[model samples]
Target: MSCEKVLALLNDWLDDELDASQRGQVRGHLDNCVSCAQSERSLRNVKLLVQAKADRGEPSDGLRNRVVDRLTHERAQGPTSLRWTRSPWLRAAAVLLVLASGFVIYSVVISGKLPSIAHATVAEESLARHIGTGVEGPVEPRWPFETIEDAQRVLERELGTATKLPIRSEQLKFKGASPTTYGSARGVRLFCEYKGRPFSIFALESIPDEVRQRSQCCFCRRKDDRYLVACWAARDLYFSMVGTDLTEGEFMAQLMAR
Candidate 1:
């Protein structure tokens, strides 16, 4: 197929709206045509972040408070002075966590393992990247850019494809973007603000199937009331977010809620 034909069908291709033959042709073209592939990936990324809806659901009555009481605290802050020092997820390493519509489940190693980037869960690594900024705290311009479009162009060059990650996903304001490594996968880490609160998002070409599958089933650090680690798979991209102080509902709304 010509680049023009492939471009016209890009959205349909992403939606899986094309028939078998058409899909194959588009896929084949994208596989061989660097320019077309970049357009496809960049458009897909745009839709994933901009058009996506949130599903954070509310926690049961008294659940939030009870969990908070059990969890201990530490002194720390984000690059923006957001107070997330509470080490709720940090307290216990192995815990059963859940979230979303009916029931969302989290896999193992929920504690402070800080596993190597190659093996760490998106949540774990996100947390480390978050707090790991060391004494200086979270700094600005980790990957400097003025607009989301600028970041997109840079990501295109870095990943060998075009990308336009949103400057704002819903209420989250784009803060910064940095190259990141998670499980042999390379992606960008975005610093953002939700209603003035700080958080980090890991947007990668792809994540491990196990991680994505587990996220579909659900994942969370239930006891750590002060902080939230969540992941979701959307189209060709995977996102892992590390934030603090949002209610169970807020967290769920970000991912698996119905």
Candidate 2:
């Protein structure tokens, strides 16, 4: 496919809305074409950014009160007294201000809701996320699956491309996997149970800088209560291994060897 065709198909291509043949053509073009590949990555990042914005939490009490106060003041002034409404520039600026306020409110709420993630500590976030995520009902989201291979195929469509999965091995005994986010990039989260203990592996696009060992091959561990979160970076991906009842460095030792 030519650059123009690939660029036109980029949205559907990243959204995985294209058919098999079209997807192959786009993928092939991206592999050989540097500009197109960068464009594809940029589009993917933009999608993730939009998804992050869409998942914003509700407005906080203080921000909500302030917004209400502003609206009340404007209402008390009446339309005729609000002279800014007469100028297009001022009207646009007013709209932008309200939108900016909404953005701040959403940011505050999300940070309050997921404090660990807001802090961006890989091990800490891993521990928090491990405690939070798992299958909730008889049937889970994205159609659910029992293996990473099945999950990879399913999530490739969700993420809109061919992809690879993390933390795959016979020893882990995959129980389930789902689509997740790693900062501003796409991620995959998988669950496993071995020897009757629960574990979670979060696969990320890049290794976050918060890890203490991030300076050297990017590996670190955080132990909280019964959970042990070991984060590391390897070729083309980053992973966080969260499990319970493991020693301080047990998971790290094993993961480092691999």
Candidate 3:
């Protein structure tokens, strides 16, 4: 089996979803491929760690009583009314533990301390290159769209207003369309500055298909730093911008406003 096919099947194999023959093929490939074996081991370890942490605490008496009471109430109504009772506290705790574990794993992976599995190595290299030169060098040239008419004209010439919403310059301080890079890929982006701060928006034409699939729509801040980035998609367009000046909430507000 090919590496990609094996990698895809590994999850199903771990879940015991495969029949004997398919499982044998996967096992054979894994036995010969050190890289795939390491990946499988790492994934299994991470899952086990997260599960162990999530299962650390038992539900309290109060929670147990609530569950029993809810179940009893349902039973009194009819067997057809029966449903599983959920513990909100347990759910919240599980979510917190998973996030914490994921953060630790991400930190380890980003710091280049992880094992040299092929996929992990490629991810590390890609992140490094993106951080090193993605947003560095010359700043994108700002188009002079000072007046309302000028803004409309620039948008018309460069992007054309057909795709963009009408200008709301009255609500902003510095309003114009500018080009910037999104993530690690080279692309043209749009910007609309609010007050003295800038909120960048990306044109749909510029972003690559791969990046849009992986990242979330909300803003992300670099660890131990003030840099904030907000990303969103509108119709065919995708946008992400970074600035250290605004809080995450403020950045998200600006993005929603646009």
Kindly report which residue stretches of model 3 are placed more than 4 angstroms away from their true locations once superposed: 1-168, 175-178, 183-186, 204-206, 209-212, 233-236, 249-258
Question: Which scores greater on lDDT, model 1 or model 3?
Answer: 1
Q: 125-152 in candidate 1: lDDT tens per residue?
A: 4433433342222323222233445654
Superior by TM-score: candidate 1 or candidate 3: 1
Per TM-score, the best of the predicted structures is: 1
lDDT of each residue in 211-247, candidate 2, tens digit only: 4243212122343545555443432244555665654
Top-down TM-score ranking: 1, 2, 3
Among all windows of 10 consecutive residues in model 1, the one with the lowest summed lDDT is 93-102
| Full ranking by lDDT | 2, 1, 3
TM-score of 3: 0.31
Candidate 2's C-alpha runs over 4 A off are 1-147, 150-171, 208-213, 216-223, 234-236, 245-258
Candidate 1 segments whose C-alpha is farther than 4 A from its true place: 1-171, 209-219, 234-236, 245-258
What C-alpha lDDT, on a 0 to 100 scale, does residue 17 get in candidate 1? 99
